[model samples]
Target: MKAIVVVGASLAGLRGAEALRQQGFDGTLTMIGAEPHLPYDRPPLSKEVLRGTWEPEQASLVRGDNIDKLELDLRLGRRATSLDTGRRRVELDDGSAVSYDGLLIATGATPRRLPGTDGMEGVHTLRTLDDCLAIRAGLERGPRVAVVGAGFIGAEVAATCRQRGLDVTMIEMLPVPLEPAVGADVGEALAAVHRDEGVDLRLGVGVDAIEGDGRVEAVRLSDGSRVEADLVVVGVGVAPETGWLEGSGVKVDDGVACDARCATSVPGVVAAGDVASWHNRTFDETMRVEHWSNAAEQARAATSTLLAGDGGGDPFESVPFFWSDQYDLKIQSAGRLAGADASRIVSGSLETRRFLKLYGRGGRLVGALAVNEPRRLMVMRRQIRALPDFDEAVAAASDDGSA
Candidate 1:
């Protein structure tokens, strides 16, 4: 390939670009981004950046001599308008285009915005560095914060607000937080984490509207009640940033549909990060993961897949992994914990709020979730990969010293 291009100057994009260079691709490398900043760490934006532990600028993932020596054209603050797969070039919003022999789509995701809430002051969605900075400034005012959606982002934001001594209310349409991702039982267990921290959590309620004269002053709930709030932070979830590929013939089923190798339906165009969905040979299912770890791992896998033929690239097969921090609890999980028919605590107890829960489907170990139990979480990850019987996995996950 003479020229290579990557959309979405994302963390995954940076890693994929570096991997390509490291594999000795001395061609024209171009990185494009909608955001003005370089590829940076986003996991810290909600926690560290909000807590004043790090500045928004400090969240840049590519630091020091990492990307400086790559000699790639870094195109920041420009949106990729359309993809011309036939012409092998990406048209930009500025009416220019970048031609490439190979292209990687890593455009990640955008926070799902609330309906009729656009341009409303104090209405925030935490997706970018600027958003985090604005919210951090909002927190400094100690405003009564109403965080809509009690998923990972909402929970973290509520926790950070509570820590900052702000009046925080976390609302979820579901009966429990993260019910869609981590099942109901484990979700309720973690829900207690929020309650114990003094967060006013409203479960099983949908938002009617954001009410105010000119700024967000309250959130009308479905139950005919309203919570007084000076700010509203929406963390409902994110949708894949695939609008640019609408007519590009790249399969877009919820995301850019790829096979197990991260190769898009259109040849010479592969996708990674939140924008890519594929049948994972590991779990034997088609899924799109929106976690930081998944993005990094998939980018490396996509890079390998992109550099194949002349060089060998391994097919991507990974068990999904992600974690969250809230108050005094360190919640971690790996593998697919949602589809399991049966779940058991192999060691420790949820009553203590520090236990490892193993999930099984068809009597085979499929997933594990742990709270403040890193060692057992690691063991469970290995056992989940082993695909042992329920009894074997239970014994393996036990702290009895041997599997």
Candidate 2:
């Protein structure tokens, strides 16, 4: 390929471009980004940036010398309006078009906004640097913060707020935090950590509305109880940014549908990271993960596939992994947790709020979580990655520390 265009210019886009170059692709590299700034890390926005321990600029993914080495054309602050697969061109909002020999879509995702909260001051969602900065400014006022999701982002925001000495309330429709991902047992165990840190966690309840006259004053729950707050941080996950791909024949369902090799439905095109809903050949399932690590891994795989041409590269297969820090606790998990038929605390007891939990489905080990127990969790995570028998995984996880 003489020309390669990567849309989105976020972590996945940056990593894919770098990997293309690293994998010996001497093509004309071009990147298109809607954001004006270079690709920066998003994980720290809710924690370090909100706590003022780190500056927003410090979250940049690119280093001083790293960006120049890629030698790619950057179309920053340009929104892609549509894609022309036949002509191999991308139509931008500015009425310009960029044609390419190969294309990689890494448009990433945007935080889902709560209904009736749009354009309201003091209500925020953290997705980008600007979003974090706005939330940080909201925190500076020392107001009571009400977070409207119990997922990683919401929990992190609540933790950061509590650590900052702000009265924070975390609301989740699920019965426990991360219940959708980690299951109720592990999620309940972790919720205790937040409660111990002085966070008011409200679970199994829906938000009726975000109430405010001009700015956010309070949030009403489905039970008719109102949480009076000055700041409302909504961390209700994110949706893939794939609206422009409609009618583009790219096959987007929640995200751009890709094969096991990360190749899209449209030939000569592929997708990675948050924008990719790829069928993982390793796990024998289709998944769309929004974690930071998945983006880099999938991007590298897509890059290699790009360089190898059609039907030439290995499929993308990596264990899904992510971590979250809440106060003094470091929570980490790997593999699939939702579809597990059974699970149990393998190493440590949940009474101590520290354990390694293993999950299994249909006799196969599927997932694992470590709560302030890193070493053993690493081993258990490896077991999950290996797709061992449930009985064998249990035996390995119950092994003594010497193992």
Candidate 3:
């Protein structure tokens, strides 16, 4: 029987093991997670978990019976210190090692820490369940909250702060929230939401330094402004957790380099989830995405390759899909709209915050972003996957039935 080792007990790692089992591979499954808890959904850490809407115990991704049925070897609360590709073993920080026949590197990224605040008391990040637990405890202390970096995580944290009726200030280096992911226009839409919710949305400025006598007391801005707050949540972003594999012979550029099948450069080793960057078939480019759907989709492909060498049918080029729940809106989008030639107002209106924006490149449907209209995006995803003729469909969809 083959022994499969999966590092990083994340959403992808858990799902990858399940996929291996589903593929009828009765192998020795060892899952290594740095965090002590079992695999749990992370997207909720910023929204529901932080807002006191979902308890930490309830945020678990894998339920009871799934692990026992799969017969997985769970290694919780232990960090894999390094990888030895030659010996096919993973070294743990506690001076132990686990050898494997097949390896899947799913160790997800960690929240980028603010320099000089590592051991600080109230500085927080929302990544693991322990981070959520610590931050939630601080939230109970009723400390004024300051969130750095206005990406999706920061925005969600600010929304949660408002939900909890805590005094919150969101600091961003960009002029608008979510500038890098969504364009300026879409980012402005999100910034407007925060403003309407009475959040202190400070844009175009970053933290000069976090200052306090002992614990976090205030955030000093680059613009020479000081905002007094008892707590600071740094949501700047996440960096891929690939440092442990430095000498493992696994190719690591921006992330673990892989082909369409999620195969690492090293034989007998595979990578998936946010840490894996491979040639994207749909866009015909090399890219790495740190999204929930991408992780789940890639894990299935990676596991299939490990078990039966199926390599997931074809090079995955489907438009990526991601959704975030903030307040009353469900924002959904498919495809890479970052570098589109032009975006046409498709089915919805941005003014009302309930519309869809279709992006085109060389006269083809490249991407679509919908706010509160998930069905439209679902149809748009099908069109993008099929690579349909944009002109004819736009003309035909005049009557709602075809689109």
Candidate lDDT scores, in order, read 0.87, 0.88, 0.83
lDDT by residue (tens digit), candidate 3, 191-221: 8988888889889998889998778888999
The model with the greater lDDT, 2 or 3, is: 2
lDDT per residue (tens digit) for residues 1-403 in model 2: 9999999999999999999998888879999999899999988988898899998789999889898999989999999999999999999999999998889999999888988888999999888888889888878889999999988888899999998999999999988777767888778877887888898989989999999998999999998899999999888889999999988999988799998999998878989999899989768999999888999999999878877788767889878888888887788888888888888777877777688888898999988888898877676767677788987778766746334
In candidate 2, where is summed lDDT lowest over 10 consecutive residues? 394-403
What is the lDDT for 325 in model 3? Answer: 79
What does the lDDT come to for candidate 3? Answer: 0.83
Which candidate ranks first by lDDT, i.e. highest? 2
Q: What number of clashing residue pairs does each candidate have, in the order they appear?
A: 2, 0, 2
* 1 versus 2: better lDDT goes to: 2
The estimated TM-scores of all candidates read 0.97, 0.97, 0.95
Which order, best to worst by lDDT?
A: 2, 1, 3
- The TM-score measured for candidate 3 stands at 0.95
Better of 1 and 3 by lDDT: 1
| Candidate 2 Cα errors over 4 Å, as ranges | 399-402
Candidate 1 residue pairs in clash (backbone atoms < 3 Å): 40-60, 40-61
